[model samples]
Target: MRQQNHKNTFLKTIPFTSIFVEALKQSSMWVSSNYIDGNSQFQGKLLLKVDSQWESVQLNLHPEKLYRKGVGSDDYTSYCQLQACFLKKFTHFDPTMPNYRYGIRLQFGQQLSHLLCENSDVFKKWFQFLRRFCIMDKFARKYKVLGKIKQCDPVFGQCLFSCVRVQDAEYHVVKVIDKNVITAGQKQNLYRELSNLRKLSQTQICYIVEVFEDEQSVYILYEYYLGIDLRTYIKESQIYQMAEQSSQGLDEKLVADILYGVLQAIQHMHSKGVFHRDIKMENLFIPEKKRLPFVVLGNFCYSETTDSTQYKKCGTPGFVAPEIFRSKNYTSKVDLFSLGIIFYLLVYGKLPFEGKDQEEILRSNEKCDIDFKFEKKICKKISISGMDLLKGLLNKEPIKRLSAAQALNHHWFIKMGTRNQRNQYLQVQRGKSLSTIIENSVDITQSYYQSNSQLYQSTKEDDKLDRVEKEFIKGSLYDKLLYFNSIQYQPSKIRRIQQST
Candidate 1:
């Protein structure tokens, strides 16, 4: 009977001889699971087929042995060893069984880095999880595994997680998407642009969401934050929540703090020659703790500038600047105008130029009438000075609107608290003295303008226009050239001038 059992075991192991040999030759087959505090219990396979599933084979994985992978040592043996662990799990299983699989579920206590670190197989598994959850389509939408949320408006988005372990490595999987559709190339381009921007900005305005393509659309994987946004902070009165009920809503000082951080972020982008065409309350994210909230500006589909513009006519209607609708030549000031609107919203829950119709709103923009009634009633409790600062930002004309930096210097902010001086903050890194910080910020702004000036100049060289020639032949080829060269690519002046004449 024992001999028959041995013969059966040998026959079964014959098909998986390579994996058995690999286990013998390699030593790092098992590793300690430190990422999650729980003991590394070998959870069996997730069934891929209707019934075939993984059977757990108890193997001890060592910590030092696992560290020997992409922190790179010539651990070809480790690779084989890891494979062997999977093979061993399937050793006793019947291949013909409807449920025969091999995969180990690595559970962790908490903390994201545990899943992201060191072990190559583990990292790859984690990345796979991200792809499956955050970037996969069939699972997120088709299955509706991640339900929808109203907060992700104009476009709704969703996310989920899956975990895996190979040796000492921990792996995590996350998925994300917009309710509307998107293409692969569009996803790639947008993700690349966002990745580049995240590295470029010194401030936390940009929050990077890891996105990849799956099927017809792209999926975005990100860390989940159960934090509040600046809008919520203002609305919920966080200060009041912390056993301080007397302090409700946003105060002048708090508003300044928020604006300072926002401006720094916008300034950082402008310096890069990339304009955030859409800047609004919903786009920004803030954590509940002491850490500052960063603006997560989105909807680059309609972004435009002197050198780059897409006439997609995108943006929230009320928040969009006047110039976008007017067909007038415009620049980064459009964003400033949007920022002004946000500033108004931050101070007063209602918009400054509300109207029953589009025509009425346009008229309001022309009149620049910012009523003080709300500010008088609500903001008086915060600071009259804060109200004035908001008024300065809520200027109707883009020209008259406060430049992001100038807004930082308003009397209300200056008196609120000791903030990093604008110039220092731009030039030096974070954690410097207030005055130095301000100077650093100014220098950074100056450097940005300088860099952008050079970039714009280069872009112009390829698509340069002879302004004089254009005006001279304003009715002919010259007009055509200017219109063609424009980012919007519309023959705007010719038709309008012709009609008027």
Candidate 2:
């Protein structure tokens, strides 16, 4: 009977392994190895292991190039095949396939345009590739042309050209492309920009997968971050809401750490004169861990270089700074203001300005009519210092608002009581210079999450910061937001005074 039981367990494990391997083979993303010369289709044996169990799989990827003689060719052939290995285990079966259909998506929308705009030639190639790629449409037909643009002879386009997922610690090549292009020069331009960004972010941001350009459109290759976003993290992951909620809950320090890292990235962009006009919870991506929550400032369609304004009114409603709508001219401070709102959400797990419509939210944002008092009441566990920091950051006046640098240096965050001492701890924690702490912190949460409550208290005093802490410890999603809809959102006195003035 013992032997029979053991054999039964082995038999069950075999089916699980078989399902895993088959799912990998049929997955949209499968790693393709074995380099080749031209457009050739090939498959390679891939090994995947979960926990302690191991399984073998296959990868189907092809090397193709958009070659335009005298113009350019894809710099590397196998560049498109690398997909993240984590996704396969989680989302192996197709939604439309038999039985398995579990998957979550993380996308970089407006940000793609901003990243591609750096090189003109590449941008064109990317545009063409976007138009020419065969993507699935509502009709279930694989069509190359999803839409069209009127720039320089009506260009065609699609939503996304390439899709990738991480399954095991490696990338799987899910899709291959047939060549179509505006030019070879454009193709090379895309490759160069992607390569540069990837290289620069290799250590700073590891989750962003490298992009590749084929004949049709520029394909942004990225691994699926198998977790919820900040918005969901705030709503579902509330400690109190765990049982009643459907989403994951997060910790308080984890929320602050993610916010701090996001501020650091925005600060870096400010240093480079790049303004991510779109800053919101949806734009902030959370990793599987709280400390290493991934907040990417995506949707750069409204982003502006220090010297350009051809693009106008390119931001989401609630998060868009008032100046963008009121003043034609704006700067990186706009992104800073939005970051403040995001910080508020991270700490309080609630939107600063709640209204029934876009006009109301915009009016509130423009008027700076956010009620910290109510936030104070709801977040009874937060510290005063943390609340002060949030108040300063969420200030309506861009000038009055905390710059990313200043926010980082706020007395609230000064645990050791001196800039130098605090800077040292921050550097050690971030693994970079004090100024680059934000960048360093971005990658740490993915691998490390150490709670330092006393350190956090000594550093920053946010009265409501404790609410995030409480939520992290024992709050539930429904409990954290139980009052969100019922509570009346009123503007603070300072905001009223400013408006009156």
> How much does candidate 1 score in TM-score?
0.46
For residue 124, model 1's alpha carbon misses the true position, in angstroms, by 14
For candidate 2, write residues 1-501 as lDDT tens digits. 654664343323111111112222433332233344432233333233324332333323332221111113323222221211111111232233333222211112111000112233433443333222111111112223323222110111333332323233343112222244334543333333232232222112223343333224334444443345556665674643542242333344444556666766776666554566777766665545433544554323244555564435646666777777777766677777777777665555566777899888777767766655552232334444455567666666666666787766553444213224343553344322222333232111212123212222223324324464434223333442343223311124323443555
TM-score winner among the candidates?
A: 1
Per-model root-mean-square deviation over C-alphas: 20.0, 20.8
| Candidate 2 structure, TM-score to reference | 0.45
Give each model's whole-structure lDDT. 0.43, 0.41
lDDT of 1 by residue, 1-501 (tens): 754674364333212122122223433333333242121212212222212333222122321112222122233122112211211111223436423222222211110011112234543443333332122112333222234332442332333343222332333233444424644544444443433343332445433334443333434433343355556655675543332333454455556677777777777666655566678776666743445534445434334433454444445656777666765465676677778777777655567777899867766764556665542223224443454455555555567556666665543454455365433332333333333332332112334334333212212222233344223222343343343336212234434543565
Task: Say which candidate scores most in lDDT.
Answer: 1
| Worst lDDT 10-window in candidate 2 | 107-116
Off by over 4 Å in 2: 1-169, 172-209, 223-226, 240-252, 288-301, 309-311, 375-378, 416-501
